[model samples]
Target chain A: MTSTAAHSPFPSGRAVPTPVTGGRGGLLASVVGVAVGSVFFLFPIYWMLVTSVKPPSEWLTSPPVFIPDRLYFQNYTDALFNWGGLKGLVDSGVVAVSATAIGMVLGTFAAYSLARFRIGGTNLSFFILSLLFMPPVAIGIPMFLFWSALGLVDTYIALIVQYLTFTIPFIAWVMKGFFEDLPVDLEESALVNGASRLRAFVDIVLPNVRPALVATALLAFIFNWNEFSIAVLLSRGRVTTLPFILPTMMESHYVLWGDIAAMAAVGALPVVIIAFLLQRYLVRGLSFGAIRSE
Target chain B: MMATRRRPSRWSGGRRFALLTVAPATIILIVLSVFPLLYSLRLSFTDQQLLSLVPPRFVGLANYAQLLQDNLFWSSLGVAAAFALSVVTVQLGVGLALALALYRLPRYQQFIATLLLIPSILSSSVASFQWRSLFDYSSGPLNYFLGLLHLPLLSWTADPRLALPSLLLVDFWQWTPFVTLLLLAGLHALPASVFEAARVDGSSSWQILRYQTLPLLRRVIAITVILRLIGAFKVFDIIYVLTAGGPGSATESLAFYNYVQGFRYFSVGYSAAMSYVSVIIVIVLARVILRYMERPVGRPAADVPVAEAAV
Candidate 1:
């Protein structure tokens, strides 16, 4: 087979092979490997979806039902309304959205400064990056104590504040990388043409980085949405997120497997959709632009 | 007229603007992160308990002393280390193999890779819940399938021997895609010219991979390993949901232990000490990895950017 693909980094590195034709056996092995890997990767998700729609009887049946006898849409409603999953979902949405919005706004400014002005030098950027490596639990513990002292536990503000520590650094780093790659001449030219720095940034540079901004926001949202440890510790009753609620639901009497499955499915659906839709930007965002596909 | 006059001093004006723009984030990080870090450092030295009536008392080194002596503390550290080591190894191995396989088939690579990326994007708690149900002893499809094959059923979460490994399996299933994508990116970034040279010299695929591809991919592999290692060290959500360090604390990681002590037991001071110890280990590991990453392999050190090197 030919091995000349373009060098675009989108959808991952371009597929350039070694021009060696795989024999029939090699071809068969490749197909089998891909198939098995795909199944292993997808089965749990498939099971979650199927189990969410299954009746309780089929849920526990031997030779577990691959497809439900009847599609039970009630499981979702029961999960959302009766099981308090609605509150969890709303809480997660609020925290994630607020955290992402705050992180992006603050991060964009810091990133721009670092990118354009070299504010605080390179050491400052590295310092921010190092914070990303610190385990959230380490930070979460003292924050828990501090928030309790301030009577801020179980409040959205408490969670959002802590989430900023993580999201801000992330947004700053990713946005810095994006800003570095953009040509400064446009902004500089605008500045020379009587526009203020702020005006030049908003009018010229911001439009250029809009895609990166969206990608970073989505990624930050995902991180907050998936966050469990800090949320679990900081929020007890009033601001319980979906992830925090799942374990509690499991701990309660008469474990409702169907409802729990429905909750998990519903909770994961938006992220899955966002991931699929924004797969390209997702790659760049996750890597902090270290592996951008040009 | 005043605004236009001030424009000539734009250099200094820009500097002030930049600092103003950066201050909110820097200040927020300091208050939220740096302050908590300092507070936790202080709390680690005190005799503090959330459930206690008395205020915290200064008890320097007492918490650390007790932590060092506690068998559960030591055991949890071991468990965290083992979990991190095993998960990183397994994920890297499986992920690299899959990446290699996927790299060959250019036709179906994107479609399959996107499907593989699904598990990685899902929240750990949600993934844990899904896996928890899948591993359910009585009703899980895993056991059902085992029964169909006339194999003995396994209690995945309840069995002490299996609980940690079960958590590992869930993590492995979820994160291997991340490693795969990183390595696949590395593989794609390989210089095709080198591969062409090897092929022209009549090198077999295996020979090319071992002598050529593997050596070139070392930096990426190191990166993937370090990232996964750091993540695995902080694993809490999956274990928290799957077993809560259950079946006799068999699955308790260091982070989970900290969670239980601080939140469940209200032993604030002790948990703070544990957090400090964990943070030290992570920072030390990151430093060591960064040092190793800086060592020049075929290329000059200057060729790798500082940001990428640090990453």
Candidate 2:
């Protein structure tokens, strides 16, 4: 057997292997499998897009209007402008951007320290992210009371405060991984050149991690943007955001699919766009530095 | 670079900048995450409802005691355990299959990968509504399509037994893609030669997948499973939207139960107790999985020798 055909020991960093010979049958099966998997996987979002454009008459048709003859734009407008919808958009946007900024600021500092200072063991960074398992809902009751006590309930502060539960840890974890790939020599050279440590970090290290920062910020913001339970319980409808308000719209009998779809279309737009436009960074982030490590 | 040449004096900018950088994140983390976690633990022992102005009366373990006796508690635990295991198992299994299948493909890997990720990235709330609609009895195409096959039409959400499964199916659909994406990345990272050599030795695709692919994919699979399961255990919006934990409370996971106790009924103390019980359980489970998933390479403690001494 050829060396090219023999398995390489290295798992990652391989050139895309040439397609194996005479495996069309297996490859064909794989395509069918992906088709089957992706349909159920993607159908809901596809349905959301489809419904967002469907005429009102097709909303609950028995057989379903898998295709709609006329696309409507009214739902998008009404949902965005009517019934505090615009306010919801502003609120979600504010909370997301604020949380992302705060999380990145705090998280970057911690991550850079951990990376450069060699604060703990090599794996300490990984262990820090282990806290990811602790669900935010676990603290919902205490936080609800705590925020109420401080009279911070129903405010942007509450949203930011709540968002840190996940985002802080997330930002720190991802940035630490990104920082690991940086060589220590640059910082050392900067220190040797009489540049202060802070300057070296800001000038040299921070610039290189730009892509990871953007990825982490976008991801953290999206998580905050789409958060539901905390938004519902903490803010009530007074501080309601898209996720909170969308559920309320669903509970009513005369659920306007068009309006819901319209808002969802707009709500999901930023994230879907980010998920695609920043695919390289997003994929790297979602890989969470695991696949790359090998 | 190997050693601190100057001992970086205490008043030095390096020392202070490092300290300052560490402080903000640590402070926010403790205040936001750790403090609240402990407060919830404290409230678990006392009968403290938020709205009631009266000082929190020390109930001393009564909340935990109540949880032990609450039938709903046990039921939700059963539901939670079942949900977590089934969802994780099926997701990992199917995801691995899909990933291996995709790795064999000649082209469009990025497109295929993106489709796999789209499901998880969509708003969980909307997905829940769509699933609810898909399983709707009267006019849903799912039932209509199944009806033509001479199958008995059944109430998916309305039935107590079927409700959790209905929720699970939706979750499975959304998250399997996530596991696939993660695993595919792992598979793509794996060296191609191992499988090629296995084939040279006359190994079948099944043999290569089992011994060569699966073993190499183990660490990543373990990580993905733990991450996904943790999320599964906290499932909220989908269930809340789909069944509201109904059909006679059949679908209430610990999350749903905590929400009702804390938010709807305003039994703040009771909710706090449940919260602690859950946080402790989840944290313990997380630690256990983290330990098992990452045992030998957990070199943070091992790296402590040089770093702490330098400090």
Query: What DockQ do you compute for every candidate structure?
Result: 0.45, 0.40
TM-score of each model, in listed order: 0.91, 0.89
Model 2 whole-model lDDT (C-alpha atoms) = 0.72
Q: What lDDT does the true structure give each of the candidates?
A: 0.79, 0.72
Tens digits of per-residue lDDT for model 1 on B93-192? 8888787777766765666777799898888989998998899888788888888899999999999999888889999999999888777766666666
Segments in model 2 whose C-alpha atoms lie over 4 Å from true places: A1-22, A120-131, B1-15, B52-55, B288-311
Q: How far out, in Å, is residue B128 in model 1?
A: 0.7
The candidate that achieves the highest DockQ relative to the unseen native structure: 1
Local error of candidate 2 at residue A287 (angstroms): 4.8
Task: Give TM-scores of the second chain, every candidate.
Answer: 0.88, 0.86
Error of 1 at B136 (Å): 1.0
* Regions of candidate 1 where Cα sits further than 4 Å from its true position: A1-24, B1-14, B286-311
Which pairs of residues clash in candidate 1, taking residues 3 or more apart in a chain or in different chains? A9-A293
Question: For residues B1-311, what per-residue lDDT tens digits would candidate 2 score against the true structure?
Answer: 23233324322336567677877877777787778878877787888776788898889989889999999988988888999999999999898878766665535665667756876787787677677667868756678778889898878899988898888899988888878877765655555666567766887666766777667667667778877778888898888888888988899999889888888887878988888767777766666554432212212221111112222
For the predicted complex of model 2, DockQ is 0.40
